[model samples]
Target: MTQSLAKRVEQIAPFQVMAVMARAKQLQAQGEDVIHLEVGEPDFVAPKAVNDAGQAAIANAQTGYTAATGLPELRQAISDFYQTRYQVDVAPERIIVTPGASGALILLSSLMADVGSEVLMPDPCYPCNRNFLTQVGAQARMLDCSANPDFAIDLDTLAQQWQAHTTGLWLASPANPTGSVLSKEYVAKAWQIVQQQGGHLLVDEIYQGLVFEGEDFTALSVSEDIFVVNSFSKYFAMTGWRLGWIVVPEWAVEGATKLAQNLFISAPSIAQYAALKAFDQDVLAECEARRQTLASRRATLIAGIERLGLPVAASPQGAFYIYVDVSSLTDDAMQWSLDLLEQEFVALTPGADFGQRDAHKYVRFAYTCDDARIEEALQRIERFIAA
Candidate 1:
């Protein structure tokens, strides 16, 4: 007989993106044409400078482990990035390089949560944030966001959830799935509340560079108590690189460093070396081009979905996801998504994977594919809806 999994492991839900991608791959392998729009990975290639840096690092035998906090140059680069992008004075020593933004979440949860402590996050947000909280033995409190409000966190609801036992708050601006961006004013207000309640704030900025409109703000720029987590995945087109960093408050730096050493050993040495070149002008230009492409895809997708009579609750200003309400088509988003996969050969993520509030009526589409593929998928979806 197979041994039962640990209770902690059993409590976590399966990652929905992986499940959808696997099904899409299986269909493709069987010679079935499938348009995948479920996974939030960029279709762009890594910048040539990044590739060259990786090759150079390997040639120079930079394969051995560095400090758990990451290479000094990479850390300094990260600091400079924060300084340049957000006008925040971040010291290099405050940065901790990790496997990915996911890794940083794990580390943050472990560092912040005591058993039975509560961590509040927005509903229909990144599902992994909730799962990571559970794994750390923290109560994951979901605050349902309004579609009319562009799925942004409501300050009133957040204040209600701000209790003495609330040890942390997890926020994802230009959030996953919904692609909602929090305003600077709102972020500042929320940070003040969390600080007043004696809790830490963790901002997941993995999609920091993917904004299409308005200015992107880092939480650190607003408050020093905030722990900013970012990755090279989305904007840098380095998902497989599995490299990211966290900027902690000055006092928490030593504790976070120790946790990084104990938990991750160090981020992949080769990825760190490669990411050193991620800030070069040539690479920046390439990433900017990709951003423009995503902006175009977003416009195309919104128009297509509207034509199909599907309701997009809000216009996403950042990230490449369009969270749509498909209640008119079907109430069961999972079944609707599966039926679309089988009938229309298009893969999407059910909103249930993000949260339970009216989730059955919603579906999320990722516009990470090329323009041609996106157009094809839109046509297929239109046909499927007509049927």
Candidate 2:
């Protein structure tokens, strides 16, 4: 007899792009040329200092698990990073290192939300957020958000959605898929509303250093009551290393640490040691140079898409993706993406992976590859559209 799976497992929706990526990989193995813009990870290698540190840790036999809250020095470094980078002061004790931003989200959702409670988010958000809420038996409430005014959640929308069962709000800066960075004033105002309602606000700033066009600010600059999660993945080019940390309000520190101990024990020990060098001047300078490259690629894709007469729903200020309006081309972006991959050998993520609000009319293009490849993708897309 087959074992029955948990009901919650069934409620989770698949990340649609993984299937597209798998098919693209299969085609690549068969000697077909495929351009991959479906994934959201960077194509850069880890900083030299970071990789060296990892090797040194291994040479020194430092593979043991760390403290549940992480190394004290690492936590202090993260706290100091907030001070120097964002000009905000955060106590080291309030920081808890996790396996990744995903781990931090799981910890927050588990602690902050309970069965029958609701977590408010904006539509066309990072889809895993909803799945995270679902895993905790909480509802993911998506409010209709527009790309105009930069995909922000206004005070009025928050007020209208406020309900007896609403537990908190989950947000992102330099948000995934859309790459819209919410402004400091806007985030402060939203924090005030959440405070008035006696609820928590969690902000994911994983793409903090990747900002290009506007001022970059962390939620800590607004108020310390809000929860902030960041990772070494995006800015440090350490995705495979799987290390991230969370900034919790002082009251939640004990509980968060206890949960970390039980759920993850600690983040990767080698990765933790390696990330200590992430703040080195040389490493940071290299990362900044890569940021410029990403900005140029963003410009290339946006201009090319516009030249092809395809509408862009919003302009991405940070991160590496452009959420495009493909309604003129096809009502079903999923099918269109599949057909594009099969016919054009170009892998683009359909907006269906993000959310359900007119998702079929939009697709997310990640300029994770080099500028030359991004230009080539534009040329191929133009030919595909014309054909």
Candidate 3:
């Protein structure tokens, strides 16, 4: 009884999206119609070939721990994919298949972040990234980018925010909430800046293939000096598979492998094999088709939000989210989110989950569901606002 939880455990913030999802689920259980736009995972199932590969792996009983780094074959596939898709040649040795993007992040934060470490990330980023760094006693210094066009960080902004304790910078292409993409020029310059300053740069490319507008650039194309965290969860629709990968600089591969060994013995065995199929031509084509579908979904959702008068800060360039400025409707997004769910059975995420900079003035609507559900959610929002 005298023993207590670690004091740092208190520092971990709860994911508000999950709580909103819970209420939505409760409404569903009670036979009420709840149109979901809060959760980030795609509604599509894994491509048939990918699913078949998983089934085959299970049938073959190929379920055992792989190299702490990853299955050699899957790593090579990812490498080949970079060459084919982005003209970037990343050696297979540098790729680390992980349990999920979160696992890759855990490995990164554990090895790179320390008690006095500071990770500079854009405001309204994927919140879990901050949590991962926090777990390692690293401070997440969120720079307010909500006001920037496309929420993109300029060289000056990043330079000004670079602090003495800043050991790493985390960025997302097709960033969360805002769904904005950073340019190739920005990545190259940022890479140069971080290295010159003796810090590391981490790019979350989980939303890589889901880009709709602007250049579908990969940080890997810039240089191998960057750490890139990617997932099958987004483009491949493999959220439940719990699979992702990280590309570390060649020099850091051994250290990363050691941490991966301690943190996660290996990625899910079946997932590793299944993800191999995700790199197939047919699978890649299917993912591209899905990207087009999401582009359409984005336009539909953006149009509907405009009609409601809660305009998006900027139309998102990628990812399936719109960070709507809710200041016009309500200053407190959390309460507004809860009320919308309870009143009109429309579920969405409040901006408070992302960061403190004007967080109360925004809400994120994910278009991961189908057009029908998205349209329904819009109708519900219209009804809620009208009433």
Candidate 4:
């Protein structure tokens, strides 16, 4: 009955994690104590202040649509956040509040991609990045960056991969799965190389605040020309709120705004008001506390994986995930993930969901849960491996 669906929709791959998540749900319904480690969502909720602000917005009837770009006050709040936190002065007009980082990426792809044009990105990147580019009929050329220990993009490698129809390169700092972050020096140089090639550079820094290991710098600091995608989902614990923002260069703000006006009209008014409180000092302190908890969980998971002799694909510097090479144990990570859930009651994400770089050999474990859950998941892994 749905054979008439568009070819692009058919080309979109199913998110294998959701399948695993569904199975985990079924197990839970059956009264099984399934420990979930597959999902990337933080277990923390938004700060109490943020919650109160959202409720207050609804009570005050502050639910009208904002400008296509965003509420000027929220944009200015983000600007102030940047200036105070990063020492980077981003003008309010350049900031575009989005429905979520997903929306932000769509706006970017719509503006930048065209048929026959390609965008370069690292393999094992956020899977949705490829899908977003695909929806626009643009080529999502995922380069194999698994060989890079830190998971940072190589400027020289990027230069070699630039094609005649290449429109830009998309990258992430403190990226998903491996949680690898790029240094400020690397980003500055990468920007130079891409600029020289006459192509744009899009940076996904959705996991900005959780960076515990390396230098934390925004692509915005590198230059105003960089298009940055950020979200409240990870660090701010606002996934369900569906809020995010994009920092576009001054020259492209109008184009971005027009797309936003048509595609989304505006981000949720209530969420926008709530996110304004996310920059509050007390709220930020709570987010920091959550980050520290995640850091502890990360240590526990990494040590357990090491003890099990599983090879880490990359040293995770931030974010909640750790990419592991499981080829020694199984050739199909998806099947292995399913089996682990069914037998050990521990769920994880397979690499196939992320990319084609030895996709069957890798899986990602997210330590976004509590330390106790992390410990329990590791024990299950140990037992499962021993058996």
Candidate 5:
């Protein structure tokens, strides 16, 4: 008998971030001093309080599976987080804790879309969004986002792109790779369009607390039909904890709960327990300090890249990434990135992995490294560009 993969599995594309990270690791193993700026993890350690809570949970034998919906305390804490930070009201019952923000996306796609349904998102979005849609047998459509508009979603363009088959929209505020934050006004307008078309809006807020420029916007503030997804990974420096939660509308709660029960069983018990303490005053302050660090790194890196003659397609107002136009240097970004790794020992992501709109002429640099490491990378990149 011949073994075969399912059609959906066969159709799914590999995550480009992992591929770049793997290649960087392979080169480093060969005695190369690679400066990795390809991955999206924070360079700092998780806060002490969060660590202490995890240790305590382990000591107290809290390693068992939690409720599929999550522990009451963690849910309540997440509810309070939204209320306090965003001034939005969210009941604890509306929150569903999952393995990570990625898990939430999977559950959401399953609950909201089906075979032949379409999910619309901006180009140069996080690759996993499209992959998750394909895994669930949904069509992923890309909306063209221009560099002149800072890679933000334009309402007129979206209206034109919306189809009768479209069932949902996935938007990222403080978007990954671009770091563009969607304004509350823009989100409201977009929500209006979605509602008029009988669709749902899924807003990824994983980078919520990392905004450095204007005030952060929450989707729930715009409309109740919006699904707000957030994680402890980015802002809290809890990448390995793999704990996140979603705020669903009252109508979607029952379906999301049932799906969560069947698919995830529950989020990690110890991690959820640890995350409950993440809302304490001291812990919140520590997280803010980390955000300040990222802000500093953003400023430093943007200046450095601009000085190197690369045009920043968008100045990231939130997330710790700087997406630059590299067409003048080379149109083959994948090759440019590989050459950078080999010759300059600097690892970055090629733009083609993000979208089909001349992404090959661009590259994304993560400034999640420390000040000294960032400086060294800038110096190396400058020398490479000069040569």
Candidate 6:
């Protein structure tokens, strides 16, 4: 008899871009030059201070596992960061550091979700979020958010879609794929609605520091009760360090700590130590410079695409991606993405990776590379369309 796999395992969908990315890599190995606009990773390395601190930790042999809740100093630094950056007063006691924002999501999902529970989110969101809910046997109910400006969920969508079994709402500001931020006013309204409905509001602020044109409002600024997920990976440029933290209400701290202990045991001790330097003024200045670079790149890419007559469903105000409407180009974004990769050696993420709501008409481009490469890619795209 064949051994059966867990049903939850079957529920998880593949990260579709990985296949395209893998193919890109395979072609690169065979000597093809590929322009990658598929992945959301930044091209910068960790700040010098952060790298130095990590090196010092390694020299001092500070590689032991930290407490499941993470280092006290790091937590305090995060608290201070909130106070200075967002003007929000968050107690360090409410913070729990994990492997990455991914780990934090797992911890929160475990704490709040149960079998058969529904977690509401927007369609065309980060694809992995639904899988995180599924890992705990909870359902991810994606409400169609195309009608909303910025492709973010508004109070009306929340009211219409939130069912009795809905446990909480998972949100992202400076969201993936689309790179649109939910407005502070919208968040405040949604928070009040969730509270009235007796459900939780979880905001993914992983891209908090990357906004270009407006105030970078942390969800914590709206309410102390909201669960805020942030990471060192994005603006801090510490992707491989695998460090992130969650700020929950004081009541959830103990339970979250217990879950963190059982699940992660702790975040990396070295990374925790290094993250302390992430708060230094010099390091922050460097990161800010990089942010400015990304902003310029964003302007260039958007202008180029628009000049080529491609439609951007929602113009991104933050993060490093632009989700373009490819309906005029082709009805099948998935196949179109593959054809671009094959013919022009340009790789972009297809909408299939995000969600099924009009997905075939959308494609996301990452401005993670330098301006020169982005310009080259646009030129190639214009030529491909002409042909």
Reference-based lDDT, each prediction: 0.86, 0.89, 0.88, 0.90, 0.87, 0.91
What is the TM-score of each predicted model, taking all chains together? 0.96, 0.98, 0.97, 0.98, 0.97, 0.98
Total clashes for model 1: 0
Q: What does the lDDT come to for candidate 1? A: 0.86
Q: Write the per-residue lDDT of candidate 4 for residues 183-267, one digit (tens) a residue.
A: 8888899899999998899999999999879987899998999999999988999998999999999999889989999999999
Clash list (residue pairs), candidate 5: none
Clashes of each: 0, 0, 0, 1, 0, 0
Q: Candidate 1, which ten residues in sequence have the lowest lDDT sum?
A: 145-154
- Model 5 global lDDT (CA atoms, 0 to 1): 0.87
Predictions: Cα RMSD each: 1.5, 1.1, 1.2, 1.2, 1.2, 0.9
Worst 10 residues of 5 by lDDT: 11-20
What would the TM-score be for candidate 5 when compared with the true structure? 0.97
Candidate 6 residue lDDT tens string, 196-287: 88999999999989999767999998999999999999999899999999999998999999999999999999999999999999999999
Error of 2 at 234 (Å): 0.3
lDDT of 2 by residue, 179-226 (tens): 888888888889989998999999999999899877789998898889
Better of 4 and 6 by lDDT: 6
Name the runs in model 4 displaced over 4 angstroms. 1-3
Instruction: Report residue 152 deviation for candidate 4 (angstroms).
Output: 3.3
Top lDDT hit: 6
Flag regions of model 6 displaced more than 4 Å. Answer: none
